[model samples]
Target: MATKGPEVVTDSKEIAEIYKEFSKFPSLSKASIGPEVISQYGGKYCNIYTEWSQRDLERAEWVKFCRQYIMFYDEDSIVYTGPSGNCTELQGELLTEESPSGIFKAVLRKHTNKKGEEKQFLEIWNKNSKEKSINLSGLDMHGKVYEDDQFGCLVWSHSETHILYIAEKKRPKTETFFQTKPQIDMTEEDEDSIKPEKQKPVKGDVFVYWEDWGEELVKKSTPVLCVLDIESNSISILEGIPDHISPGQAFWAPNDTGIIFVGWDHEPQRLGLQHCTNRKSGLYYVDLTGGNCEQLSSQAKAVWSPRLSPDKCRIVYFEGDVGGPHHRCSKLCMYDWYTKVTSTVVDIVNQPGEDGFTGIYSSALPQNCWAMDSQRVLIGTPQRSRKDLLVINITTRNVTSLTSGSDAGSWTLLSIHQDLMVVTWSSPNCPPSLKVGFLPAAGKEQRVTWVALNETKILPGINWKILTFTPPLEQKNPKFPAMNFEGILVTPSEREEGAPTPIIVWPHGGPHSVFTAEWMLYPVTLCRLGFAVLLINYRGSIGFGQNSVFSLPGNVGSQDVKDVQFAAEFVMKEEFINTSKVFIIGNSHGGFLASHLIGQYPEFYKACAMRNPVINIASELGATDIPDWCTVEAGFEYTTGQLPTPPLLEAMLSKSPISFASQVKSPVLLMLGEKDKRVPPAQGLEFYRALKARGVPVRLLWYPDNNHSLSKVDAEADGFMNITLWFIKYL
Candidate 1:
């Protein structure tokens, strides 16, 4: 049986205290170290970075206080406090790009939510100008700019005369046909209405719906390849792009002869593009000399992030299979522009190397990822529980870990400029901060040391360590063998050995996504309140070899549930984990597991919390933006017109947490975003009603204005506070 639950309270002193303690950690939500700044002088280089600070988490407003910082990095220290520009994009995202010749830089501000005619701004910066103001705002354009990595590309031509980018195509004007004509009397100014026929009104375009890319890319419907001539102050939409395909990740061909981009096929259907790389997309090169467009990539279902080498001789990109598991280890291949030959630089790894290097779980490649030699590229990937940057020799196919094996933090390449690289490193206890490092002289990647750019937070009581957990070497599935997984344990250092303290098990969302070793607000907040947190990255998680990832399918509810339980039990035996006061919290798929933990093992947890969790797979199948996720996760391939059979649907229901809801006794706190398209709020309501009917303590928090992430300032802050209070009350 589960422990008794607490009554719903609007405010409490405990909530206030926890909120104040968690607020000390600054939120680096919109922070980034920018566009490749290669200006070096006397072993020192300059760069631009932006950070956003919220006014107050209590406010429901939708704006942020954004600040830009100019920093200089030298062999000794960094100058990070200089504020250079007052130009900030508070309402949208600011994207910057520097020209090859270093004479010009382009800045684009994408107004994300609004779809008005003028939704984006393109500005050019004259780097060599002597005037006080070197930023020149360019012509206003239609539709929001494509700032997303999957479809966004902003590059300047080699000729230094034009800029190429991708954005939502301009929507045609629509009006109701039943609308009345202008009531003004005819005059010389209105000769068109008097002497000629009135303009025809669109009959039904107002009610016609055009499907968007779904989820995070909701505003992005039809992408149009466009070019801007800064020298002539003219912008034109590029022709020759197929009408059935949506273009993105565009770049200029050598010498500005044409443009190369990835085109996603949207003819039959268009699925959500966010967090998914296995969509049906192909590489295409459009020739300006003859307006000819040709498919450059040979047979491939998905290809992404085609980055040209520094010499422009090779185009390197990531390729993956189509459908099913949204993300997996993809093949890294290089396209020789001159020879028109494609060769794999790195293939999928079934197992880890002797050095503990699993195959590349590439998130994405940086714009300037090439080293000075151009034969090498730096790829950032999840190395088990943490992120690691691997320096791969394109020619030799040899890989080296850029980060030391002992480091507990995650390292991501923010921007790479030739020999100098800008990286963001953070751990569970440390706040996210920028670090700069230089590429070592060939075979010396292990010797490279990073210089800290900004100030790092030092928490005296907070400490985190990575713990490896192994499963029994038995056959669950022969083709997909079992593998060892790891979990990150965060604890307060003040707690003595074998001391009694509450333990919280945090499983990451995305049955596919792993819990990275970065600073997370809620997990750390719980740890600060004297609770130990075990963030587990189970067997099927990325960075754990393709075989382990493949093992997840067909065994979703049983395999993943046991792995998390095994992780908790493994840690409890080794650490001073308080088993009696154990709790669980999760968002999305993590929520799915939390539900399973409490339902299947009712007496294990004192209380539980879930955010936008998938409760019933059968109910969510038709509503979720990724319907294919339903088919693939149930241990089957996703195919159009392949709805589940009755027995299959029953199997899916059995895999859902709702199937075991009647056995649940633990108090459940559900947080849902009403506007979420991924997992609708109804899923949470279903569980809420079931728990309520069973007389189990349950509360549902519904945020109307938020999305799947619950990223709004008030939603996140308040949600964390409520979760903390609930755990405290149960304890």
Candidate 2:
């Protein structure tokens, strides 16, 4: 650690100006690839929807317009000669799309009123008749529309008459006596004389170890599967789904007799689905007409992303350990409905190819993973340190990499039609953009064509280089076998000849999550502000392999901390880095690592910024939604729903950042979301008070309305500005 502190400069005006300049850069909000083909007026076309917003930190309106691209292709080639489509004001927020027959389209939209009430409805429209459309709102049947995740889909029946979706049933009404009590002979002056009767709060089910429920609408009510009849505008809740099962991502089974979905065995009063990966979940099939529900994954403890082949012969799903984190290695399995035999297509181990390149497929596969022929599946996997797009043949079980090159970066498969695949590609240097290409067939090489829906807004001549680094053997823990771990160094495109640039070490959240070479606004902003950013994908990060990710659970503080230190040392050796001005910033689990780094290496860093960090694991075990996180990460057996013992508490405290609070000498900033339930605001406050009592310079900024992701318009903008100013003053 540096012995001398830099001179402090508090210039609110300069900070405001820096924020104003960067707010002009456009950023991607959402992107969707439409169906492979849509028949309109006897013409076949493909549609792509993308939403973008100017980086406005002050204004809350993030999405304004939806840019649409209609692709017209000939038998020989696709035409890319002129402007293909136009932009329109987005109709509510497009939730899901279903174009079963290619002539008709069904879309779900989530609309919120000025009063803050939200409603989700389905719109069925004919491709040829723009004016003829049917609106089916769940409100008519006292059901509230809901979706499991951002990419959650709505499935249309084989005949395209009914849509299967997940929704919440209305809560029961309170008794009239609880609502109000009549007071006799009470005058205005006597209002204080009459005391209101106190009613004891209704106790709900207790959540032991689970993810934070946050403030999702579905959590407050009972979630159920609902089928909406487009012609009758009638909605029927699928019955016989056990009360403990919360079904989502429902798709119509072959022949339209039943629906297949991933269902979580939820304790309504105990748990909510936000950020939850450790729940007891499985793939299930529910008959629509007879209302019979069947568990399809009896052999696996947890399963997700179930896909039925178009031919309706086999089913594919991902299976993983329920005891481990949700992002652990997932095995691909196929179930034959006719033979009732379940076979593992791929095990949960990282398989090395002939070239010795080893990796694991992402645990959370895309909703549409099955190919048009149902013989291949597209998946995103972590290779080396970056995310790549790969396709796996179900029969041969051969995985082929469809993307390469240093800039290939991360690719998300949005929609695929027969031969054409629509995806979004992004990297540290390149902004995210939508692309179209033909799927690679066996023994054939295919090239994808990029489409420009919106112009990539360059930060006015700003350039950056993303370099990868691997730590030496000494950084590895002897307890675990040797594994590959890497970090990314992001340096500004232009530097004063030999001047050393200040650097910020960033560790991503989800100690189980990996930091890919994807386009992120925060690190890019820091680079543009003349700072080098190092993103360390320490031992516990996902995508490396099951062993690496599971390694951190039992050795959180020590192993992860060393990985970061090694990364810093490796970067410091570079002549262009200012070791004296090094700072640290992280969120959630990343924040946990940052806190540990500052404490363990008190003299090494100049300043530290933590966003919703886990300060005291002992206290967190009781209040956090994921209490199991504490037990599992502490190297203890998975024991949630049980009270913590003295020994367990001791183990958690030993690994907590609070254990090192007394040694922290660097000025720290705590960015907390008041509404955050994951690492409750209390955790930050505990550390803040401790640092203040120790006479250390510390500041805490709380966003009252924001949750874990402080990415809300105003909160995100303000956070960026505050961190920049904090680093400017201290480093």
Candidate 3:
């Protein structure tokens, strides 16, 4: 690591100004600081965490805008899009039901071929018989489809065929919007009526997470709830209130009489409460019978999986602050209509404490962590150290220990189904496995089976084992503090008996996020291709507590790059890794850190890949719509410190990776999204031009329609495929 720079000011304001100037320069270059300067200045940790964590929005309630996985089932099979955009996979296959509950089943899958044309498919599955592939590619589906009460009837937002809010009903056997737009016939009123205004076609998934009542609205292109009418053999749109809201989690009152959904309010035309700034929303009652809506509540925060009881009288959800650390305690709250009480189900589990942020310094996450029955609710609270999972009962206010004495860094709840729970577990020394346990009628939960990922044929020839490492220590509070740096190593499934394998060091995005042993698909795919992958849990990553998380800001680019280098070195010294071909790649903030490595320690890596890197930090600060505390928390303002235009310009210029473009000799592949509002297009273009000017081997790939991160099926898949190919050819 580079030695500390010159002694600087200790006064808060003057030090802030110095930092402003300091950040402008390339990240603390060893060559840039002179001894004379070093003698004049010293450095200290800025206590940004306490202030930043205080700004942590409640972990619950529905925030106006957050993205989540939206999936639909066909037959008995469940399908979902890959988080990395490889392609939608058939998660679980469902057998054909002899006496089907519904007439026909439709599967929604996104398809992207070699040429990269994006399209959505609605595969119609036959319940009575088996068919090779239910191809609905030719069908023109403009909006969303919902199941109505009618047996064969379905509702849709088919903008192409039907006018806005015009619900089209069709027979179960009939293809609704698949063929043509819904055309309204001529009438006396039609003669004088004006055509509706033209707007862009609705694209992508139709869900936005909102509060339980479907009242909070975050505007997503995907629709959250699907309204079905099974008896009519036809369907129509369940159109969310305030038109244009993207629904996230939904809860329907028992009897399925009244539906409550969480979404953003994009339009203010509807008669319900309207939310702002894409925050979590609350309580909207849609009378399925009357086709009307009622505003139930108004709250904001990200609410996870709001569930209704069998009787549908009570709603339960996990709520947290948007700005809070992801590993902090999130509350399980229950809402009752009869009592008009919104009370905490369990005494705010995972409070602000050491074990709460589990993982090496708290990069572990506690989300989608709840289950419920008629009598009580169960919440999975990550215990201090993250080695065990606690099952807490909301009704009795009692806590039961589930898995104990496990390695703190190795165990996590994977999925909860009915009475069965699936977990992905590991330790520094044990490979991860899928462990299944059943809820017991008496005493503790029952341990049933432990299935290693190798037992499945999902991906052939891939063998994964657990890795353990101790986080490097700090002078103060050295005992595995939150956000410490430790690295995990992954080896290829098909490897020579004793030959060293290629290594690709990867830093997860979200300087706040960590690498979990959660059966990652991309890394496994890389392993399948005969490469060793190193996932480093760097400082500033979440799941660790406030102090470790605080270390990331102002210095994330510098410190995280060191962690990457350290991981690479660790691999080189280990028996399995090929020291000659070490490569590094990352997305988002990870992308920025990648570039930092090439400029800062160009010799450590053979080649590097960066996706949506933030090269021009100052430019991003000016362009972002971030809240105030976030800006201060990021050390942007403190670093820049009210400098005049020229000094500020110099400061920004010094930090821009473009400033060191000429020094970077390693080849680089740049991937950028055209519509990325978070890290604008120029961040990529500036670096590309600079590298090209220096005659460095660099290539730029642009996705015209994606924003921030590549989410579309084609773009996401192509990104991984191309990046892998790049690694194969260059690393």
Candidate 4:
């Protein structure tokens, strides 16, 4: 006879306390340190930079009080606080030397009222000038000027008269028509009141493929490039842009004669912007005076990170087949304006390190990639599950690794000014911190200096160690070569020697995504709860070379499953791990793996917890925003409009977790986000129904307002508490 799991328990006070403790664990959200905006004043190379810190968790929400710190740094490392005291949010900042009094800064500010309503305004400040501050609040352009994650820039023209930026604007309202019939024997007043008013139907896009359409901005508003005249405080929308194109990453062309930007066609059937590498986008240039738009990369399927050479003779950009897999290889192309020719400077293909490439430059490369000489660019690429900085010589097509070794964590190249390179460095055991490094001149080796350490609340009784293991050769799938995979083993620091501890196996989503040695809240919390947490980066995960990442496309369930089982088995060999008390947790694709593990190896795990897992590929194909995900992962070529045929659906079903549902014997907890477009709520409900129909122990916890990330503070807190309880009850 099957045994039922313990009844679901809810302790609101305990959950609140856990959330309070988790809030103190700070994570760096944003950092601004780059060469283009670094101010050189009074014989000191200084810059105005800002960092957003996760300060406090909202009591009733899943977000945090992201406190902003705007500071000024000089060559001597003296930090001066700026005017961030009254602002609830720092929207954007632009620095320019065109002002008569040294350098001036234009910053956008957002203030939240007691009622939680937000109002934004623009402020111009010059410390040395008599007009220390000027507020441009009344000159509203109907949308926000700030776009997060390196998508848009608030920039000043070379002449400094006008500021250019991207802002959302309301779509034009459509006219409505209606017909009315006269009322019988109605008086004049009655007839006047009975007149029918035109009814306008609500208009909105279905967003079939565009899942990440309106994040952090107003819905139904179109993003448009606009120019603001500082002197007159008047805004003018840039003209000549086609209605079917939405512009981003806009900046002034050389000499401020025009604007150069990357634009995506407004295809209703196009995939979401989060999967931008799969979208057909192009680089375009529009003259400021004539407002004539010209397509720059017409021959390329997708173009991004377009930058003009300092000499103004050439333009360099990345071009790739957007229809390829998520981590598609891209070619660095240089266009010579003088010769009217274009050539590939370097082809970034996937291969083993030291001789071959890992992946394309990060999508956020434009923010801090250019070198002083303009002939070299600094980029970050995934190498064996860690992000490494690479210097690519555009002139010679040479790629040099600046940071690589056992201590390899993740490095973000922020800015290169003169010989100084600014970066954010972090490892599995270390939190992200800002660092200053030397930009090697010619053949000099690179070195770094720590600038600021991130504030972290260390849990008194928790500890973690990084580990790697090679599965037995016999366990490897014939189709995919065996490679050593990596994982982090987190455990309570004060456990008795040789004492058995419950183990939680965690697999990351995006079979293409790798688990970096970054600070994650959930894993740390699990470790604090006296459980050994194993975060595995199996085959097909990024950070490895192209071969390893592409190896699992046609073998998702089989190869990936074998790798996870091998990892779990290898870890279980340790006498300190209680094999009988083992549990598993996963999100998205990771959840897919967890479901498969519990089903295929039914007796191996005591319980399973999945968050927005992909249950059935066949059903997911019609509902998921990334339908191409199903086809591509199933070993089929990715296509935009192709619907799954009967045979293809069968193949997908055969590869899905639902195929092995009947074999699952462990209790399951399904945490689903109702608004998740990536893996719809139905995916979780489907798995729940399957387990329930079989009388397997099951429970469903749904967050109605959260999205796929489940990152909202409330949902995240709830999920952590529920999962902890579920594991404790069943493991």
lDDT digits (tens) for residues 1-731 of candidate 4: 33222221245465456556655654444444423335555433334344444534555532223333343545424344333443253333332222322256555556666988666655566655433333433445455554454355677676667777777653333322343345367566775675232223224432223223532321423678888787877778898997777788787777888998888775655455563465678888899899899888864487777766655677788787766466545677887766867888877555655564565635656454667677777777666656788877877787777776424567777656554566667665455665555565555434433444334334566566657767677756565554667777777666555557788999889877777766677886566556788898897777665566667787888888888888888889963688888999999999999999999999999999999999898899988767778888988887657867888998899999999999999999999988887888999999999999999999999898888888877787778888888887874
TM-score of each: 0.89, 0.87, 0.59, 0.83
Judging by lDDT against the true structure, name the best candidate.
Answer: 1
Compare the candidates by TM-score and give the number of the best one: 1
Tens-digit lDDT string for candidate 3 (148-195)? 111011222111111111112211122323446666677766656743
Off by over 4 Å in 1: 1-45, 48-93, 110-119, 127-141, 182-199, 473-477, 496-499
lDDT agreement of model 3 with the native: 0.49
Model 3: weakest 10-residue lDDT segment is 46-55
lDDT of each residue in 1-731, candidate 2, tens digit only: 32222222246676566556655555555545555554565455666665656654455646556666777765425665233466555657556464565566666777787989776667776766542343444345545466547215677888878877776664333343344446466566676554332222223423323332443432434567778787777777788887776677678887888988887765633443454555678888888778898888874476776777767788888777676664666788898877878888867665344643345546566655667777887777776567777777888887677775424467766666665666777777667766667675654423445554444544442344444555567766565656757777777756665467788999888888777877787887677667889988887777776777777877888888888888888889964688899999999998998999989999999999989999999998877767777888988875546788999999999999999999999899999998777778999999999999999999999998888778787888778878888888885
lDDT of 2 at 165: 74
Q: Quick one: RMSD of model 1?
A: 5.3
lDDT of 1 by residue, 1-731 (tens): 43222222235676666665656555444334454454635444455454544435555544444555666655434444355667453554356676776667677765444546344567777856421221112233446678777788889998878888887776655678777766655566666544212434456698888888887787788998888877676777888998889999999998789999999988787888878888988889999978899988875579989998889899999988888788888899889999999999999888887878888777578777998799899988998888998899988888998995636789887666657777778889887776677788678788776776567875667788998877776624567654788899998777544456678998888887888888787777677667889999987888888888888877888888988888888887888678888999999999999999999899999999999999999899888888888878887778776766897798789899999999999999999998888888999999999999999999989998888999887888889888888887787
Backbone clash tally (model 4)? 7
CA lDDT of 261 in candidate 4?
88
Clashing pairs in 4: 61-714, 62-712, 62-713, 62-714, 63-713, 384-543, 385-543
